[model samples]
Target: MKLSYYLLCFFLVFTSCKKTKTDLTKITAKTIAIDSTITSAAAIDSMVAPYKEKLAAEMQEILSYTAKDLVKNDGDMQSSLGNLMADMTFDMANPIFKEITNKSIDFALFNYGGIRATIPKGNITKASAFKLMPFENELVVVELTGKKINELIHYFIKNKKAHPLSKSISLIINDNKYDLKIHGDTFDETKNYTVLTSDYLQSGGDKMVFFKDPVKLTKLDYKVRDAIIHYLKKVDTIQTTIDNRVILK
Candidate 1:
């Protein structure tokens, strides 16, 4: 009888201590409306005011002046703004690439869609640079084979858009055949050329797959917008023109 009583107690304690699995039977959610009912926190506002004021002033500071509006669609195959962008990239990135690899960049090519905004005929500021290129793309030089260079030329010819090309290349499209010149020399299929472009394009962006799997790729670790800002700061006046870098004749 005593044994039976102890067993009953032990069974009761074991059953009580045993863990039971929980299964979610149902879930309910509540929606909270966020309207004008919320008020700005005074402490947070005070903390952020000083930084905002400094940034506003810096953005408005004049960097340079332009007598004529620099736009990307002002010409048939080239524009003032596109030339400036491509030239600036070549000018800035070539030095860095030379320092690292001891080789000069053959040319620069950037897409028309990459130019975000135009420089109006007035004072240019830091805000202008930001508006023109809000992306954080870095410059890279890719050593492409002569075949790849031909492919690049073909791509440009097919697009027929005013893609920014530097003065180093003169591409004249005629009928189904095209005449190409690099650095004032005729395009040679036996030589490899180093081309300057952004990291985005190097990764095969915009269907420019030729940039991938190059002979060599050297990153300049320089942002395109910073180059523009640097160029703007160094010049009192910004002057650019549509040249014969590309002729669709």
Candidate 2:
């Protein structure tokens, strides 16, 4: 009787251990499968598509009404449209981003290609901003010296059609040459300056490699399209006036 009891206990313990191991193995396998599914390129793109579409629609609707009505004079539509784009870039960088990174960003540079179309006269909707910035690019901050900033200006001048800028910075370009100054002070080559711009620029798109050499870089989770949408929503009334911030000669 005693031997039988001992044998029974051993059998039960062995079975329980084996069952636990099997359960763990099953769970681990399931987890791996889930990870693999998420990492698939097609799956990721499909998931992102809906949001992109929604944003594009909203931006398009907004542009249809806003710039057309606001722009009065001839050729004013293009100029006003550019100003709005610049304002969107600046506003997004300032208050909206201050919470994420405590450091105050001195300037913002927005690429012109990102602006899709001129806003038409009337109501500006979320869809309009999306059309302007259709890409899924996110906001990225870079730190660089004044020398690099000058180089960026030169890059812009060289690639006039592709390079568009919205800056809190002040720069003078004469005869395809540039003199860059940021804020109220001249750029100090030895000192570092923090710049807020899109990830597209940081990634060497449109030949903007100046951001690549930053001592520190930070990417915000917020999308650039979303930022423009938020700004447009805040201003129920749209007005397009030339700030003369960008001069193309």
Q: What is the TM-score (0 to 1) of candidate 1?
A: 0.87
As a whole number from 0 to 100, the lDDT of residue 206 in candidate 1 is: 87
TM-score of each: 0.87, 0.65
Question: 53 in model 2: Cα distance from truth in Å?
Answer: 14
Candidate with maximal TM-score: 1
Please tell me which predicted candidate would have the highest lDDT against the true structure. 1
Estimate, for each residue in 107-213, the C-alpha lDDT of model 2 and write its tens digit: 77766666676556667666556556788988877877777877776776766543334545556657776556666577677887777788888988767788886
Model 2 stretches with alpha carbons more than 4 Å out? 1-78
Q: Which tens-of-lDDT digit does each residue in 89-168 have in candidate 1?
A: 89888989999998899999988889999999999999999999999999999999999998998888778788899989
